[model samples]
Target: MNGNTERQFATNVYYDRTFDCDAAKILPGEFYYTGQDMLIVTVLGSCVAACIRDRVTGLGGMNHFMLPDGGDPASPVSASMRYGTFAMEVLINELLKAGARRENLEAKVFGGGAVLRGFTAMNVGERNAAFVMNYLKTEQIRVVAEDLNDIYPRKVYFFPRTGKVLVKKLMQTQNDTVAKRELDYASRLKVEPVAGEIDLF
Candidate 1:
């Protein structure tokens, strides 16, 4: 069956069983893909979330990633971008396997806030936004919408089937848990060894 027909069938079958299903929450370094009507949700600070969907097939997914710094820029695609590359690839590949067309893919990106003060020198948010924008461009995917590089956290809700996205800029509270979580993740990346890499060739 073609992408559209498959999606329609799935929707019809699911609608009767579970109408208006709750959203599946995606945390940092994770992604979720489906053709169903349920929403994909995530909260972000310096981390970036790419909500990508195929206009033709209604297949889509969202990924949250923090570009680990201090890697060799000249390394392979998988190494240079660290978890960022993996996150992007996994989302896109899953969409394709579920019948999404490469040419018809569209993206809605969010987060990348400079909500954490100590990482100002690193400019983590700015770098992540730039990386995602450039990566999508290189892959020839059109970014239909984006809200990035601000000073506040955001809550993003993405509906895969319709390619719709809703973003809410969060209030700056004293105990900004989202920003703190992203900051902690970034800090951990600095000390962890690059995955799937070895010195002996």
Candidate 2:
């Protein structure tokens, strides 16, 4: 495993009474994958999550991430893109390591809400939405479903074993927590160096 993978893997495992299954809640820059039947969840504000799984084996995972403030979107190796790349690669590589095949991968993406105030100029939500879609396309992973940029924050629940996702769009009035968390995550990105390179498998 690479350094980034070690640091970014989600560790908040819990049992969800509501779903009667194990669950992992991934925060910004974190990802979770498992071959066992389980739920992976996250809340997003100007960030995105990709729930990827193998159609044949039901092995999969989810990742929550946002590209840092600025970088040339056209340059695949730019700093911001690199952060996004590592977030994605770490999740996909983990799934592959757990016995998922490259040919059977499919994706469902959600989040990237324009709920953050004073961030309209940067279009952070829009950029993140675009980046994930483009990245999946370049990787030849089929996007089975998506709920991209909008003006409301979202709570995403993903069942990797069944390739099922449930998305709840939060009212603008109730988005304070989501906004604050993402804002703090973005600030940390500005100061912390991006995790080391992770090669996609």
Per the 3 Å backbone cut-off, how many clashing residue pairs does candidate 2 have? 0
Can you tell me which runs of candidate 1 are displaced by over 4 Å?
1-19, 72-80, 193-201
Error (Å) of candidate 2 at residue 17 is 1.6
Candidate 2 ranges with C-alpha deviation above 4 Å: 1-7
Q: Weakest 10 consecutive residues, lDDT, candidate 2?
A: 1-10
Which candidate ranks first by TM-score, i.e. highest?
Answer: 2
Q: By TM-score, how accurate is candidate 2?
A: 0.94
* lDDT tens per residue, model 2, 114-149: 887676467889889999999999999999999999
Candidate 2, lDDT over the whole model: 0.87
Per-residue alpha-carbon lDDT of model 1 for 1-201, expressed as tens digits? 221110111121122223266567777766788887778888998889999998887888888888766655345464437566656776787778778888899999998888877765667788789889988997889999999998888989888888888898888893278977777776666665544422210
The best candidate by lDDT is: 2
- Residue 47, candidate 2: how far off, in angstroms? 0.6
- Deviation in angstroms for 177 in model 2? 0.6
